[model samples]
Target: MVPSIRFALRGATLLAAVSGMVAATMPASAKAPFRDLNHNGKRDGYENPDLAVDRRLDDLIRRMTLEEKVALMLHGTLQAEGGRGIGAGKAYDKASAQELLSRGVNSFITRLGPDPRTFAQENNAIQKLAEATRLGIPATISTDPRNHFAVTAGASSETGGFSQWPETLGMAAIGDEALVERFGKLVAAEYRAVGIQMALSPQADLFTEPRWPRGVATFGADPATVSRLAGAYVRGFQGSADGLVKSGVATVVKHWVGYGAEPEGFDGHNYYGRIAKLDNESFAQHVAAFDGALAAKSAGVMPTYVIAEGVTIDGKPVPQVGAGFSKPMIEGLLRGTKKFGGIVISDWAITNTCPEQCMAPTAEKPQGYAIAMPWGVEDLAEEDRYAMGANAGIDQFGGVDNPAPLLAAVKAGKVPLARVNEAARRVLRLKFDLGLFDNPYVDEDEAARVVGSAATQAEADTAQRAAQVLLENKDGLVPLSAGKKVWLSGVSADAAKAAGLILVDSPELADVAIVRVATPHEMLHPHHFFGSRQHEGRLDFRAEDEATKAVMAAAAKVPTVVAVDLDRPAVLTLLKDKATALYGLFGASDAVLLDLVTGKAKSQGKLPFELPSSTKAVEEQHPGRPDDSANPLYKRGDGIVLP
Candidate 1:
């Protein structure tokens, strides 16, 4: 049995007593007032709160073994039961946390169990484990957008735990810079409350390709507009121009370079849809958002999963490869030209091998889906892929739990030890800058108090209302009387009545009819539940289609209003002549739409992208260019205002 205290020991004596012993593994003889990391029997410079941030970071890095350094530069999320990415899982438990932390994982993708309280509790538990480790390095938690109502596979979460706001596209439609900033501040507060120090969001991808699956999350197609909104978003998350506040989440602005301009409008899941023929002229518009984000000093940036085909930087041709592995794009452009000092994380699973079916398993490829997006170097070994990305200037690996490959690469001389040290240093610097090392745990009571607050919800409602743009208010048919009889489809009758309109089942018996239609999409991966119907292929809808014809027939009988949820810029030519008024909504509630039409809220939104005049124009337009559709029905920023 060990003595309770070596009270008189100092310096050499202390070192001799604690040799080969880890502070965390020892039994408590006397409870420590403050943690004595490394069994030193006293606080070290790295553990000293008064020490400078860089000094603390250096001390900690110097003490870390190579394995620990590799762990610090790697990240992963808790897998759900049956291999799903979300939902309840044993992965959030202490055992799993210990396994990952013991391997030196200093960061995690957030995996809150159910509610805000649970989220706080689980994160606290994880932080406690980290605190007890030999180095006491706190794990920084990061997450995709969770404060919005839209759900996509592997992108965002369901909005039950936090305040629900308009999607990013909806926020852009409102065009209020101040309001956008407020939304960012609110999201940052909520994230901090739940112990999440990093935000993997504010997608800087331009809305150039209308048929692109992720446009619903972008801030439209125009460079200037998106650039402004992206900058405001970064400010909100990062706090004032000076630096981050305690509540701020270090925003990781994403898909650096051009992810939205996929060839043929397909997503990054396949090789055929990579970014191709990207010249300086077209590339400038795509990088505009990143430039804006960089100006705000975003904490980090994420590369795209698809390869950039034939793209050039500084008049030099870039090899065809994913942004994570491309030296010219990431090193030449983002680092050298833009002079970005922030960490660069590869998109999820970019270093893994592409299984037969990339992405979540679907009925077409039932073998099980996994997006091993080793795009340009599909033939390279997995370890070599990781080494290549790190050597190319990527600082961290996303979606990887094992650090053995990185360790092996260093041992084999594929990646220099100095490079590993540099990568680990960048990641640690972010943690130190965010103040996570000092206090990584959150207050549960505070989390409950601030998350989903009434004021925040009201602001979301206002923003949603503003995002509803009047596209074609022919004959001033809007602001229809509250007492008017209304026939509605895709809207709840109770909600319509609450807006002061009398609900009617038949269009012929009603004074006016309203129908809500979603932009049509072809189903891609049906088996991935939340990720299914990921719209791909054609972007047009015909009037003669069964669903379109039925809605039009009802709309023909009375003065009609149509609202299209423009996830993608849909062909609106068919409904132009038949409807009395047409509106565009990115993502909103039934009551918010009623509020706008009933004059309770004014429409301040403008078109973020063009509405193609016909399906043929959509087919003929270039995927890499924005606002190039021939004879567009409505150009970018076009919004009809009615008295």
Candidate 2:
């Protein structure tokens, strides 16, 4: 047994030894304090003498006051803004962090950046802040899906220290649970090395619709598939061999119940068709994945900005109130029905709904005074966030600028003091479970050794290899002869930068630039998920595509090979009709692509989703429905014949 487990066992044995005589004389039906021992504040284990740690937790909870319980729920991320980046900018610093912790802030979320050494440094800085605090509340460094390609700005930099894998969709295409688990384990190790105690990732939201810009972040459409993969991911991330980081870094299974069925694939912008409205059966199907995640002991749950229609709060419908601040869903559904004992985190900047945009600065509205807005109107004030979110049982506030409002609310009797204590206690318990109190500092040298280590790079390579889907390979279009003057066509295909397959430090060394074809990120216009949809957001194909086709038509004069970066595979059908020889590539690194074409590596990937022949085919399918066989241009699981 691991030392931690053994230590726990010994501690339990000693306690039992002290109570043995009293226990033997007790009646059979009488309950013993041994039933609850660890005092971790969570009901984790059963009534067994062998399981003393469980008892200790029960004992701890029993001793905790209602105020302390409230403290356990008040988790706060140190950063103020919500974007795809690491570290809070000028808004928050070490001094502010110290001040917050001293004022009773229990949880702190930090970003994991591209560089491992930077992460260690940032963590060390936070450690000092924790040490300076009166409560000695250890901060939990939280990352936003850093395992894959770092999407956020500051997160992409090496200063935060994280390993980069393929996008989540790439992992889903691999369909290898064990590999996914391995990825999670590596990420956990990197996190542990950097003083990080929580991983708010393994985004389990199923990508029911492709139109959703964030769809690439999801595992895919199937709940069973997501469940198995997400469970493995959680197990790998939380479970540890030494029990040091075991319960590995606490996993936060996110966006809670239903975020996959969003209308028009918008992130949280549209709520019309987003919820899982089916009866208990359908709800079960969607929630089954979360069951697997919870079974893995996910330490946190984040509710989205969008609300379920039928779900209500104080006799009011959910959409009327921001879902993040809703009481019924968080308290009733998540905590009450699901029995989730972990922290409840609100989405970034979800507390500041008054100003329309999250990051925008605005004036506070009067109490109980509703205002008109494009999304909706409500008596929603910054102070209202605390009352509604806390009363609703939210334990943490993420991506917020000022927690002073929440603290002020507590002082003003807007929020119950008991609730604050509950939130804090829960945060403290998680820190204790993570062993952060014992050793909060991260070793920069050790971080360098582990973050982006050779093993992690190998995992990335493996993931990249598995994510490469061959959409179409017509008449031996691939496996080109090494000496042939292969003419690459299309803007994205021509420029290594646009291809996104190559991890280039410099763009000049690129092999060639065909004409331009828009990448999926460019084609779909990511901002549309926020509500804006204009042709400008569409692919700059008029100029770029025409140039690409002209070059490809010219390249057809020679023994040329045309490869298109298949972000949205539909582009390939257009390219296929024009090129003499064509091959579809999905997010492969340039090196990987070169190897495949040069016959150095074998292409093993199959399509995870169907490539429609046209946009019309896509429009015909139900927005969030997965079964699209009725009008699928090309069936899913289709792969090209490679020579």
* Alpha carbon lDDT of each predicted model: 0.77, 0.55
lDDT of 1: 0.77
Which candidate gets the maximum lDDT versus the true structure? 1
Q: Tens-digit lDDT track for model 2 on 153-259? A: 31122324455676666666667878878888888888788677777776777655555555556666677777877877787888842222443788787776566
TM-score of each: 0.92, 0.73
Q: Over 4 Å off in model 2, which ranges?
A: 1-92, 112-114, 153-161, 240-247, 269-285, 309-320, 356-378, 407-418, 489-555, 558-572, 579-586, 627-630, 640-643
What value does the lDDT take at residue 139 in candidate 2?
Answer: 67
